[model samples]
Every structure is written in C-alpha cells, then in structure tokens.
Target chain A: MKVNYFISDIFYVCLRDLKHYLKQRVRIMATLIQPIIWLVLIGNLMSGLTANPLTLKFLDAPSYLDFMAPGVMVMTTLFTGLFAGVRVVWDRRLEILQKMLSTPLSRTAIPLGKIAAAVVQGNIQVIIVLLTALMLGVTFKTGLAGIMVILIFISLFCSIMASISIALSVNIRNMETFFALMNFITMPLMLTSKAMFPVEAMPGWLKFIAEWNPISYAVIPLRTLVTKGWDWTVIWQSLIILCFFALCFLAGAVFFFKRARA
Target chain B: MKNIIEVKSLSKIFPGKITAVNKISFSVKQGEIFGFLGPNGAGKSTTIMMLTTLHLPSSGTAFVSGYEIKKSPRSVRMQFGYVSQDLAVDDRLTGYENLFLQAKYYHIPNQTARERIKILLNLVELEKRAKDLVETYSGGMRKRLDIACGLIHRPKILFLDEPTLGLDIHTRRQIWQYITDLREKQGITIFLTTHYMDEADSLCDRIAIIDHGVIKVLGTPQELKSRLGGDIITLDIALTHVAKIPRLIKLLKTLTNIKQIKTAKTKITIVTLHAESMMADILKIIQKNSIPLEMVMLKTPSLDDVFLNFTGRSLRDEAGNREQAHKARRMLRRIRS
Candidate 1:
C-alpha cells in the first residue's frame, strides 16, 4: 500500500506538468521550430567544411548533415532537460510547491516526476529532429533498432541534465540567479563536448575536457549508432557511463529536494 | 466539545537565530471557529505552519486529531486542510482541474473525487465557471475556488491563513459567510489567523491575541470587551472653556459608579459603569456650570479597546505597513501579467 501511494504520487505530479506543457500553444510552436532551425540552417552551413576527403574521413560519414543529426538530437535533449527546473521555480513563487508539500506526497517523488516529464519532452524533440534530418537526406545505417538506441541514450542524457537543473533550483530561490547560472553551465557543457564538433579535430586540452565530459558519453554512443551501426564495443562503454552519471545526479537532486524548506 | 488540536509549548527559531514562534500553548475545541489575531509579524503564520506539518518545530510538539505532528506527520496531514495566505491555485488549469489534482494528492478515488468536486464547485458557487482556466477568474472567483480546493478532501479541520486579505469588503463578507456555513453544516473545526479586528469580533468563537512571538490574551470577543469593565464618555468643551476642565473633572468624580477620568486638551474622558444614566446628570452639571460644551460622545468598549488595553498599542498602527506591502505585491503581480 505504501509503495502504491508513492507510485501514484509520481504519476499525478507528472501528469499535471504534462498537462501544463500541452496547454501552452505558443510553447509547443517554439519547441517544433527550434530543432528545425538548428538542423536545416546549422547542418547545411557546416557541410562545406566536410566536403574535403580529410574532414569526411574525420567525420566518419559522407556528409556533415548525416554525422551531425544525432549530435543535434542530443543537443536538443540537453537544452530541454536543463530548463526543466524553471517549472519548479515557477511553482515555488506561486506557492503551488507549498500546497503539494503539505499533502501526503513524498518529497522524492516531486523531482522524480519532473525529471520523468522532461525525458518525455526531450524524446519528443529528438523525434522531431530525427524526422527533419531524414527529410534532409540523412539515412540511419541501422534503421529501426538504431532509432530505438538513440532514443534510450537521449532519455538517459536528459535525465542527467534535468537532475542537475532541479538540484540547482531547489538550492537557489531567485529566478534570475537560476537562469544566470544555467547559462554559465549550459554553454560550456555543449561547446566542450563532441555534440557540435569532432573530438579528434580538437586541440589536446579540449580533447581532454571532451573526453571527461558526460555529454560526450551520450553523444559518442548516439553518433556511433547513427554513423557506424552495431559497434557494441564503443556503445556499451558510453552507455554504462551515461547510466552512472544519471544515477549520481538524480540522487543529488532528491537530497536537495528533501532538505528544502517551504 | 472536545479539543481537536492541542499545542504544547511549541517554538520555532529560524536558522538566523530569529525566534518566530515562542513557547506557546493553546487548545482548539472541535467544531469551533478559533482565531489567532495579531499584527503582520506576530508569529501567526509560523504557528499555523507548525500545526500543518509543513515546518518542524524547533522544540515542543502538537497533536492534531490524536496524531502527534512530529511523530506521525502523514496521519496528521490527512486530518486537516490548509489554505495559505497566498492564492496557491494553478492559473493555467481549469477550476475543475485544480480541485481534481488536490483530490488526487489525498488519494481520493476517482469516482468519489468527481462527485465531491461537483458538490464543492457548487458550494463555492463556481459551478458556472468550472471549465474555464483560473487565469480568467476574477479575484473573488479565484478565492472561492481556492476555498473549494481546501474542502475537496473533506478533512475534519480547515486552516485559513488570512483568507480575506486584499479583498474588498463585499468579497470579505462573502468569504466569511462561507466559513460560518462550513462550521454550521459540516461541523468542521476551523483554525484561522487574521489581523482584522472586526473579523475576529464577528466571526470567531474564541480569539487569541499574539504579539512578538507570544500570546497576550485569549477569550471570546464579548468576554474580552467586557473585561475592560465600563462604557466611555468623552466630553469636548470649547477652547474658551478649557480652563474649567479641572473643575469639571472634580464634579464628575463626585458622581457614583465612575471608574476613572482622564483629560487631554479640551476633551475629558469619563470611564463609568453606566454612561446612559449618568448622561443627564453630567449634562445638567455642564449646563449649570455654563462651561461652553462643544460635543459629547458615548461608546461601549470594543475589541479594539481590548487590544489597546492589553498590547498598549493600536492594532491598526502595526497593520499599516503590511497593508501597503500587500498592495505593492498585488500591483507587481498585475504589472507582470
């Protein structure tokens, strides 16, 4: 019976957020438009650099669009996941958090439910990016199975970002301070990783940072699935690393949430 | 009636070493409208927070519906509904959606929740606007919906923290009617906190006046008022006759059943057992002396006089800043949206 209440708590919280997300027509339009701009504009603009044989060999694909599709999908997930805590901050200001905390709902379920909703939202954006990439002539070498693997990676990657965002939100009360800190963290995480560029083409110091970056773990496996199918050796190593980071960050989020005062 | 809530020496000192609620003890009878009346920072909200299990007491404890707040918070939480000072309803969702979500949090079954929601929406008179988003609701409608949300679980007790703050007099009276109706129809005990003197006088069965983290007095409105022990008669003479005030005081002292006399400027206040019977004699004396009388006013002791008698300060003086702050916040919300 106790376990049943906990599960339902998570379900109801997630359902509320999902309903809130769907009701904003303007936000839905923005979500659809964002991935299309990144894929069509940025993907084609960088295609000239990969036209040469050396760059094509480095990219491990015939064209830049094909190689960058998976990276774009992961980047979209990264952006979506990092902003999940904005809703929490909004709820806090509006006193909705106080109402929920006063109920019998468990503290852990609050952040978990928000993270779950972010993952679902992230996956939706990933599919949009994938469809746009396909329309732009990018083909998946592993087809349907590879698409499933990409989605799993996206979910894991999004959870890590969402967890970190929620942890920061629970600790920081000011909305402007949270947004400033997010910008300070997000750009470096995205730029230093292989999400937009190849790590082999980077300088020695950046390669070290990219090698240690968690985004790279998600990007590497997703890129391998998209460009070089069935490479279990590379995929398994990164998958394990992604799972480990997700667990650590999620635990940190729950700790902060439990200790937060209304 | 038995006590539904018993608080024993409860205290809360925040991390900054600021004491918000001192060691205070009180009991609220079941089915009674108990009020905590105080100024803005008088620890009223802190006490409510502790009882609602939203904040852990730094020391001491409380029991709600036979469950200790600290030992079995989940059980305690299930026993009462809380409506905070802020309007906590979700604006993006419909009124029905807001109450449905609240019902789900309490684990009410779906069919029962629907029926309860229907009745609650009707009770608050929001049945006509149930399907519209709460953002479209007027201030009164939004507050009514907030009250309905609190009643969705049908808890044994309801805690309202400034339920009528920032509302017009009409809306405030409407909210009061709902509160009284709840107690009469459902027998639900109510614990409310407000700084409004009239609200405490007219609505609460018993009121505790708190200040500086301590409760100063607790009694019914009539009891507190009568404790001051007499009617007040104030006579304002013309400035030309100010010199005769001392003589007037001496003459008034000769009257029977007079308690105390005080003078400031041209006005003299006479506290007596019966102002009605003494009015004729006092007027005849004033006329016989030919002291240029300007005005005479008589008043029975009210809750304000009781508050002033105990706290040595007027309640309205302390409430001024808070009322302005509330206005500024409301203005900011309006500008933002």
Candidate 2:
C-alpha cells in the first residue's frame, strides 16, 4: 500500500514539475548555455593547445579538451543539480509547498519527486552537453555502452546533488542561510573532484583527498569508459558507492526537512 | 455534532523568548464555520500554523477528521484544505494548470479532477480567465483562483487565513457571500481567521478573540454581543477625568452591568448591558468630578469588543505594528537558518 502511494506520488509530482521545465525555458537555456559553450568553444579551444607534442605531465597522453570533457559534463550537472534547490525555495515562497502539504500527498513523496524531476531535467542538459561534445570530435571510445554508462554516472551524480539541494532548500528558512550553505558545500566539492587533473600527478595528500571525494567517483569511472574503454571492476564498485551517496543524501534530506518544516 | 476538529492546549513558544501561541484550547464542530479573531500579534497565524501542520506546537496536539495532525499529518491533511493569507500560487502556470497540479497532488482521479476544475472555477467566479497565467490575474482574480485551488480536492474541512484581506469592498462582500453559500450547500466545515471585524460578525458561527497569544473570549458573535448588552458608550473626557473615571466606572459597575471598561489616553469606552440606564448615573459621576464629556457616542459591539475585553487593546489601534509582525516571523525562522 505504501509503496504504491510512493510510486504514484513520484509520477504525479514529476509529471507536474515538468511544466516548470517548460516554463523556465529562458532561465534553463541561460544556465545550460554556459556549459554548452564550454564544451564546444572551450573544448575546441583547448583541444589544439593540449594536443602539442610536448604535453604537460598532469594532462598526460590525451588532449586537454579530451581529458577535461568528462569533467565539464559532470561539473555542469553538479552545479545544475546542486542549485536545483532554488526552485524549491521559490515553491515555498509561492506557497505551492504549503498548498500540497495540506493535501493527502505522501510527505516522503515530495523530496523524492523533486529530486527525480531534477535528475531527469539535469540529464536532458547532460545529453545536450554530450551531443555538443560529439559535434566537437569528442567521440566516445566505449560505444553505445559507454554512453549508457556515462548517462548513469551523470544521473546518479545529479540525483545526489539535487537531493542535497532539495534538503537544504526545504530545511533552510531564509535565502541568506541557503546561499551561505551553498558556498560552504558546493565550492569545495567541485574543486576537490580531480576534474582538472589526473590523481597521479597530484601530491600524496591531494590524491588521498581526491579518492575520498564523491565528485571524483562521479567522473573517474565515466571518464575511463569514455577515454580508454571498459573498466568493469571499478564501474560496478563505483555504481554501488554512487547509489549509497544518493540514498544517504535523499534520506537525510527527507528526514531533516520534515523536522524543519514542522 | 461530531467534533471534526479538536485542538487541545496548543502552545508554540519561539526560542525561549517569544511565546507565539500560549496553551489554548478550542474545537470546531462538523459543518460549522469557526472564526479565529485577533489583531495582528495575537498569535492567530501561529495557531493556524500549528493546526495546518506547518508549525508544530511546543506542547499540545490536534485532531482533524479523526487523525492527529502531528502523528498522521498526511491523513489529517487529506481531510482538509488550506489557503494562507500569503497568496502562494505559482505565477508560471496558467490558472487551469495550477488547478491540475493540485488535483494531481490530492490523487484526485483525472476525470473527476477535470470536472472539479470547471466546477470550482465557476464557483469562485473565475471561469472566464481560467486560461490566463496567474501572474496576469488581478489581485481579486488571483484570490478567487486561490480559493478555487483550496477547494479543488473537495476537502471536508477548509482553512482560509485572512481570505478576503487586501481586497476591494465589492470583492470582499462577494467572497463573504460565496463562502457562506459554499458552506451551506456543500456542508464543508471552514476554519477562517481575519482581522476584519465585520467579516467575523457576518460570517463566523463562533469566534475566539486572541491577543498576546492568549484567547480572551470564545463564543458566537451574537453570544459575545449579548454578553456586552444593548450598546457601547465611549467618553472622550479631558485629562482631568483620568483618575475619576475608574472610581466612577467602579460605581457604575456596581449600579449597572458594564461588560468592559478600557481607558485609552483620554478616552474611556464602557460597554454595558443597559446603555441608557448607565448613561444617566455615569454622567453624574463625570460632571461631579468637574470633567466634561468632550465626545460621547453609543455604538454596536463588534469583534473589537471581544478583543478589548480580553486584550485591553483594540485591533484597529494597530496594536501589532508591521515591524513586530516581521520580527515575530523571523524569530521562528532563525532556528532553521
């Protein structure tokens, strides 16, 4: 009985939240255009620069754009997903949340539905970036299977981030507090993810930090599949960790939000 | 009548400094409109906040439609609807789309939901502008749409906080009539809060006048009025009469049943069971004290009577200034921040 309610509620919320995706054509396009430009213009810009014969040790073997492409895609999703909570803030301000909460909808369904909607929205954006990368001669070495893997990688990554954002937005009462939370949390997670360089070139302490970062988990597995082909052993292990992070973040969010809203 | 709503000693204190809603108890019978009357700071919204499950009470509990608001909030919520004074509609969606969102939220069947949208839009008299985006709506139209949104789910109990606030007189009267019509026709129990004295007088079956987080009087408008009796007499005396009025009022209290006595600056308002009988004796005391009655008028008792009787202040006096209202909102918010 409970599970049925959960599924339907998620379906209902997602179906309706899609209206927002359509409504925010300008804002989404504006936010998404930055990453698209980076993938095409910057990726192409750095392509020739890094393809020189005497390559930097950190960028090793591959061109800079190629090495950086996976990072850019994941980073785009991370920021998009992380800041997705702002929409939830708008909903609270508009009393849409209060309206829904007063009804028979399941309380747990709300955050899950919002996160699911954000994940799908973020994936649409990821696909745009991927297609743009493809246009820029950034072919995936891992074929259709690699694209599938990358999609899963980015989806989980976005889901976890969106879940945190939803939790944060719902729990925090004021905009100022929310901004401060984003600064403390989102900045460090993005910077430490090894998005710019391979862990081999980094100092020992830095390498340890990179290995522990959840953002690193999001990129490395997908990057390996994209650039070098399959690494089955790590892929399965990383998928599990990603699932764990998504669950922990979402559960924490739903639980804390109930208390804060109460 | 079945107790469709029961609130027991509900208390909400903010951060150990502000007591938003003191331990107060009240209940609503099924199929009746209950009005929560208070000035801006009497914790009217806070009590509604607790009842709506938006703010948990520090102590106490409530049951709506046989489900505890805290323990089974979803079930409790399922039985009712809420329209907050803060006009929280989404401007992005068309009026129709917004209704669809609410229908989906309540798990209303799609077919029934469609019919409900049409019915409710018409019920609130917003049928012509249903396709327009809510952002494009006039203040009155948006408010009507909000009312329609609250009712779309066909909740047994509906809560409307300051439902007619900021509306023009015509629209306010229209809504006042519309709400009465809905309750009478649909048999939906309504819990409403308002600062407007007349709205309370005209609409509510029973009212609780609250101030400083405590309920001062709880009774039907007629019952509360009858308690005050015939008419209210206010004496705008010179400063010389300040000291004499209390003793004079005490003597009047002995001779006649003055429901309440409040001295504001240089004016003392006395509401009595017998306005004419008390006037003759009351004037003698003021005249003997060498204080002339600068102004005097006999008027009908209003919800303001209950407020002053309970809180020793008038709701129209702007007792809770805007600064204090925002400050109170922030005090509760600081915890999450």
Q: Model 2: which residue pairs collide?
A: A94-B88
TM-score of chain B of each: 0.82, 0.78
- State the lDDT at B183 in candidate 1: 98
State which candidate has the highest DockQ. Answer: 2
In terms of TM-score, which candidate is strongest? 1
Estimated TM-score per prediction?
0.90, 0.86
Task: For model 1, state the Cα shift of residue A68 in Å.
Answer: 1.2
lDDT of 2 by residue, B266-309 (tens): 88888777677888888887677677778988887766776677
Docking class of 2: medium
- List the candidate 1 regions with Cα displacement exceeding 4 Å: B234-296, B321-323, B326-337
**Model 1 chain B: which ten-residue window has the lowest total lDDT?**
B328-337
Q: How well is candidate 1 docked (DockQ)?
A: 0.51
For model 1, name the residue pairs that clash. none
TM score of chain A per candidate: 0.97, 0.91
The residue ranges of model 2 lying beyond 4 angstroms of the native Cα positions read: A54-62, B232-298, B319-332, B335-337
